[model samples]
Structure formats: structure tokens, C-alpha cells
Target: MNAEPADQIRLLEVQALDSRIAQLDHKRSTLPEHAELERLGADHAQLRDLLVAAQTEESDTAREQTKAEQDVDQVRQRAVRDQQRLDSGALGAKDLENVQRELASLARRQSDLEDVVLDVMERREAAQQRAAELAERVAAVQSETAAAEARKAEALEAIDAEGFRVAKEREVLAAAVPDELIKLYDKLRGQGGGVGAARLYQKRCEGCRLELNITELNEVRAAPANQVVRCENCRRILVRTADSGL
Candidate 1:
């Protein structure tokens, strides 16, 4: 392929812009906020699960406490009725003795029910505390996650802006080159490592980081100034300048 010397030089500018665009893309993906958000997301999920379990326990304990209180109330009501009958003297002697014995049994039953109610109350209080603590932890994690997401978004926006600017510059520079030359460059860039053109500095192929052998340097030195030359090692367009040391 043949391209004007100036046009071939412009290809290097396009390559530089392309390299910058690639760097910006890499920076966007590897932003620190991305990792932070991932960690925060995991914590939030676990905390939410714990919060749910605590809430369920709290609900269960609440129902248990209510049932226990109801049992205590029923026992107390029955004892009150028995005591009223004994005080009214409405039963014969034998019947009165039977009523007194029933009252004693009801008292014991009420005491045991009251103890159960107290135990249930204590358990419910513990569950409520645990649920509240877990809720606070979940909220803290959510706040952290939100902050990380905001940071990630800001970083991406900046990277995207720079990439867009570099791409526009590349488009303008590439447009000035001959279409056929651009086609060859694009093909080589796809096959190579994002570099289709490189400067031959001091008789070295910058693309492959290898100095050209004596034979390769002689050929390049003999080539016409307008003729496009490729590096023997990397097959990239070798853009010659005064520093080529031919």
C-alpha cells in the first residue's frame, strides 16, 4: 500500500487516540467503587435475611405471650367464682369443703399460668430487641451500598466522557487518511494487539519491542519515502521518521 508520508504520520495520531480510548474503557470496568458495591451488596443481603428471621421470631413470641396471658385470666376468673360461693355460705358443709379444695387448686393453677405468661413476655422482649438491632444494621448497609453506587456512576461518567472525546478525535484523524490505507490499518489492528502502526525508532520495531536486523533495516532504508512498509516481526505498518536511524 502507498500513502503520502504526512498521511502515514497521521495514522500514528489515530493509533494514540485508540490506545487512550482503550485505557479509559479499562479504567471504567476496574473502578474501585465496583468492588466496594459488590461487597456492600453481599452484606446487605445477609443482614436482610437476619432481619427477617428476627421479625418472624418476634411475631411468634408475641402470639405466645397473648395466649399465656389469656390462660392466666381464665384461671383467675374461675378462682374468683369459687371464693364467692364459699363466702356466701350457699353450699352444705360437705359441698363447702369441696368448694374450698377447688379454690386452692385454682390458685395453684393461676400461679403456674402467670409464671408462663412472664416467661413468654421475656422471650418476646428479647426478640423485639434483636429485630430492632438487625433492622438498624440493614439500614446501615443500604446506606453504604447507595454511596458506593453513586461513586461508581460518577467514575463511569467521567471515563465515558474521556473515551467519547478520544474517539471523536480518532474519527477526524482517520478520515484524513486514504480509505484503502485505513482499511489495511484496521485489519492489522484487529489481528494485532490494538496497534496497527508503530514508529521505527533507532532501527527498532516499537510494536514488537524488537530491533530490526541489519537486512530489515537495509530494506527499509532503500524503500521509497511514500511507500508503506511493514515491520517484519510484528507485521504492523512501520511509520518512518528522521529518528528511524536507517
Candidate 2:
């Protein structure tokens, strides 16, 4: 393949632009905010699950408390009815004695049910506290997550803008080069880590960071200016300049 000497230099400019774009893309992916957001997201999800569990426990305790209170109320109502019957004096001696004993039994039963109601109330209060604490934690995490997401968005937007600008410059520069040359460069870039061209400076192939051997240097020196030459070691297009030390 052959391209003008000037065109080969332009290819280096295109390579520089491509490298800048790649750097911007890497910055976008590796931004500190991306990792922060990931950590925050995991925390948010775990906290939400805990909050939901606490709320469910609170609801269950609430229903238990209600049922206990109803049981206490029913017992109290029965005791009151029995006491009224004893006060009416509408019974014989044997019947009055039985009514007195029945009233005593009802009082004991009511006391036991009231104790159960108190126990249920205490448990419900604890559950409510737990749920409240979990809710607050969830809200805090959500706020942090939102802030992280905003930061990530801002970073991505900046990187994308710079990448877009650099890409436009590369497109214009690459368009001026011969399509055949650009095609070969693109292929080599894909095969060799993103770099398709390198300058031969001080008898070194900058792409592979290796000094060209005497034989390779001689071959490159003898090549025509219009001919496209590749580095023997790295297989990258070698663009020579006055500093090549040839």
C-alpha cells in the first residue's frame, strides 16, 4: 500500500485523536462515581429488604395487639354481667352462693386476659420502633444513591461530549487520507491494541518500543517516501520524520 508522505503524517494525527477518544471512554467507565453508585445501589437494596421485613413484623404485632385487647374486653364484660346478677338479689341462698363463686372466677379470668393484652402492647411498641428506625435508614440510603446517580450522569455527559468532539476531528482527518490506507490502518488497529501507526524516532519503532535492527533500518531508509512501510517487530505502519535518525 502507498500514500503520500503528508498523508502518512495525517494518519498519525488521526491515531492521536483515536487514542484521546479511547481515553475518554475509559474515563467514563472507570469514573469514581460509577463504583460509588454500585456500592450505594447494593446498600439501598439490602436496606429496603430489611425495612420491608420490619414493617411486616409491625403489622403482624398490631393485629396481635388488637386481638388481645378484644379478648380482655370480652372477659371484662362477662365479669360485669355476673356482678350485676349477684347484686339483683333475685336468687335463693344456694343460687346466690353459686353466683358469688362464679363472680370470683370471672375476676381471675379477666386479670389473666388483661396481662396478655399488656404483653401484646409491649411487643407492638417494640415492633413499631424497629419499623420506624428501618424507614429512616432506607430514606437516608435513597438520598445518597440519588446523589451518586446525579454525579455519574454529570461525569458521563462530560466524557461523552469530549469523545464526540475528538471523534469528529478524527473523521475529518481520516477522510482526507486515501481509503485504501485508512482501511489497512483500521485493520491493523483492531489486530494490534488500538494503535495502527507509530513514528520511527531515533531508529526505534515507537509502537513496539523496540529499536529497529540495522537490516530493517536499511530497508526502511531505502523505501520511497510514497511507499507505506510497516515495522518488522510490531507490524505497525512506520511513519518516518527528520528525527528518525536514518
Best by lDDT: 1
- For 1-246, candidate 2 gives per-residue lDDT tens digits of 889999999999999998898899789889998888888888888988988887888898889888888887887888788788888889889988988898888788878888888887888888889889888988998899888889889888888888889999999999999999999999999988999999999999999999999999999999999999999999999999999999
Give the Å shift of residue 144 in candidate 1.
1.5
**What is the TM-score of each predicted model, taking all chains together?**
0.91, 0.90
Encode model 1's per-residue lDDT on 1-246: one tens digit a residue.
Answer: 799999999998988998898789789889998888888888988989998998999899899988998888888888888888999978999999999899989888988988898898888899899999999999998888888888888888888888888888888899999999999999999889899999999999889999999999999999999999999999999999989998
Error of 1 at 63 (Å): 1.1
What is the model-wide C-alpha lDDT for candidate 1?
Answer: 0.91
Question: Number of the top candidate by TM-score?
Answer: 1
TM-score of 1: 0.91
C-alpha RMSD of each candidate structure in angstroms: 1.9, 2.0
Residue 191 CA error for candidate 2 (Å)? 1.4
